[model samples]
Target: MSLALVLDLFGTFFFAVSGSLLAARRQFDIVGSLFLGSVAGLGGGVIRDLVLGQVPSAFDRPVYLIPPLAAALVVFFLLGSVERFRRLLLVFDAGGLALFCITGTVKALEAGMNPAASALLGVTTAVGGGLLRDVVANREPQLFNRRDLYAVPAMLGAGLVTVLWHAGMFGTAAALGVAAVVFGLRVLSLHYGWHIPRAAGTWHGSRRE
Candidate 1:
């Protein structure tokens, strides 16, 4: 019923869809799709909750389970149609990234975490699921991809949420605004091939190898 819960559910759905899409692309069966979807939807929150010494909502609250299951079912049944949009996975991932960063930061703050720790947890919440999904799927995680700007956008969003909360300006409008900014940045990064620079010698070393 709360806005935060609504945003969390939506984020879970988006991430789950991305996971299912990846599974479909890789020719994974329904069971695999469901597994990946659940991981991508709830893994981040689980990590965060564990770190905070709390039970993960995904397990404690049954409502948190619906989105991943729904997403897996939808993608499993409509793989053909969904495959036409090659970028849908990235788009949904971006949506999840945006929403999770905000909600994660808010929750951390609510749990009495400092601003710095909360922002870091927010970044974790945004990218943890995708990282696990990719690792389990035997693919490269975007967090380490040189040409992909994944964690930067998440950090920005989380930092903004932290700043706004500190300023006592965080609310529905601010949360939505922050999410929009993060989502737009993520999409643009995907579109324009924006990326954070690697270590000074890493690229050159790879070239020599």
Candidate 2:
């Protein structure tokens, strides 16, 4: 398969796994798990495609559905053992994020979008599914709250891809390199508790509801 397709599949699997884990944690039934996993796998790509004014690849292809369903099945059968797979999930998710971010930016650029708009589309592609998953699961989205270094990494990855593309370095290898760098930085951030601070005083007078 092409590198772009590979990246897309990888992203789908991890996002699906993340959603499946959440469903299992919430004690959702099999149907719920499948629905959640499928949504997580396709949600971002659908949004990305729509923003680009194209038909969603997820809807046009069957491979897009199979991986997430397979992942959900595995998670469902091994629910009690899911904790042992946490680190694995994080690694996959980070890699997927990097890949999706790069691909999103590249796709946007191909569609003649401006750099800023392309970068935003990339971030949306990377996090849209997770955001949807969180909403469906009735939990706060990590991108909106302090949890993990999520969107920042995607932004960096997309930004790098955009810069490289502008610099005439749009080869597949260059894109993969940018993705790797972003993924590495994200993993490091997670290990080191790196974070972007929220605006101070934005909630100065507010208390948790």
Candidate 3:
């Protein structure tokens, strides 16, 4: 497999693991965990393909389904051990975000998308599956909330890849390097509680005596 394809597979596996663990934490049954894991693994790629006017890449290959299913099975058996695996979940999720961000930006640029569009597509590809998983599990989507620095890191990663490609560095080495930078940034942000600032506002009410 090519380097890009390998990174995609790794990202898919980690996304699936994150989704499965979320379902297990919610006390969902095995079927639910499998379903969520599959969605979280493939949903973003499906959306990315649709937007790019192509058939979903995951459907074209069996490897796509295998990894998520394997992840679901593993999480299902270890459902009760969730607390012990929290750190692993964070690491995998961060790695997946970085991998998908780079891959998605590369694919978008390959399709002749503009830099801004490519970055947006990359962010969507990094977080779309997790958003869907959260919605399905009846929780607020993490990307939309201000709790974490999730989407910003992906955007930075995508932007970096785009900049590198524009600078004539569109190769496997460049992609991996960009992904590593994104991964490190994301992990550090999580460790240090780094986040984008939000708009400040105050609410006031008047009462009549």
Candidate 4:
């Protein structure tokens, strides 16, 4: 497989695992876990492909879903056993975010998108599924929170990928470096509780003022 394909698969697996864990924590049915896992793995890619006017890869590439379904099944069977590894699941999610950011940016560039739009799409690819996952689980989307420092790292990684592409340095090595930067930023933010401050007043307050 090409390096991009490999990164796509890895990101799918990592995101699937994260979603599966959430399903397990929520005491969802096995089918629910699998559904969430599949969505988490494929949703962003579907959006990206659709926006670029391409067929969604998941439709033509059934094999791409195997890892996600398998991951859900594994988590389902070991639901209780895996509960102790919450930290590991968070790390895996970060890996998924990083990988998806890099791959999404690369794919958009390859499709001739400008850098700014490509970077935004990369953030979408990084966080889109998690947004859906949160909504389906009846929680607020994390992206709506000012305290969630997730998308910034994705933008940074995506920007790096776009820069590399322009510099003719885009390849497996540079991609990996960008992914690592995103992952590192995510992990550090999680560890240190880093976030920008929310705006001080509500929208209504400003209008009244």
Best by lDDT: 1
- Which candidate ranks first by TM-score, i.e. highest? 1
lDDT by residue for model 2 (1-209), tens: 87788888888888888788878878898889889887887898999999988999988988888878987888877767657765655665676687789778878988999999999999999988888998999988877766478999898888888898899977888977888888898789878888776655445875443
Q: lDDT for model 1, on a 0 to 1 scale?
A: 0.93
Candidate 1, residues 6-62, lDDT tens digits: the string is 999999999999999999989999999989999999999999899899999999999
62-167: candidate 3 lDDT, tens digit per residue: 8888879999988877767665855666676787788888878888998999999998999899988888888998988877666478888898898988898899
> 58 in model 4: Cα distance from truth in Å?
1.1
Displacement of residue 154 (Cα, Å) in model 3 is 0.4
The CA lDDT of each predicted structure is: 0.93, 0.83, 0.83, 0.83
lDDT, candidate 2, at 186: 76
Local error of candidate 4 at 97, Å? Answer: 0.4
Could you tell me which 10 consecutive residues in candidate 3 have the lowest summed lDDT? Answer: 200-209
Clashes of 2: 0
C-alpha RMSD of each candidate structure in angstroms = 1.6, 2.5, 3.6, 2.9
- Give the clash count for model 1: 0
Global lDDT for candidate 3?
0.83
Instruction: Give per-residue lDDT, candidate 2, residue 64.
Output: 88
Root-mean-square deviation of Cα positions for candidate 4 versus the true structure, in angstroms: 2.9
TM-score of candidate 1 against the unseen true structure: 0.96
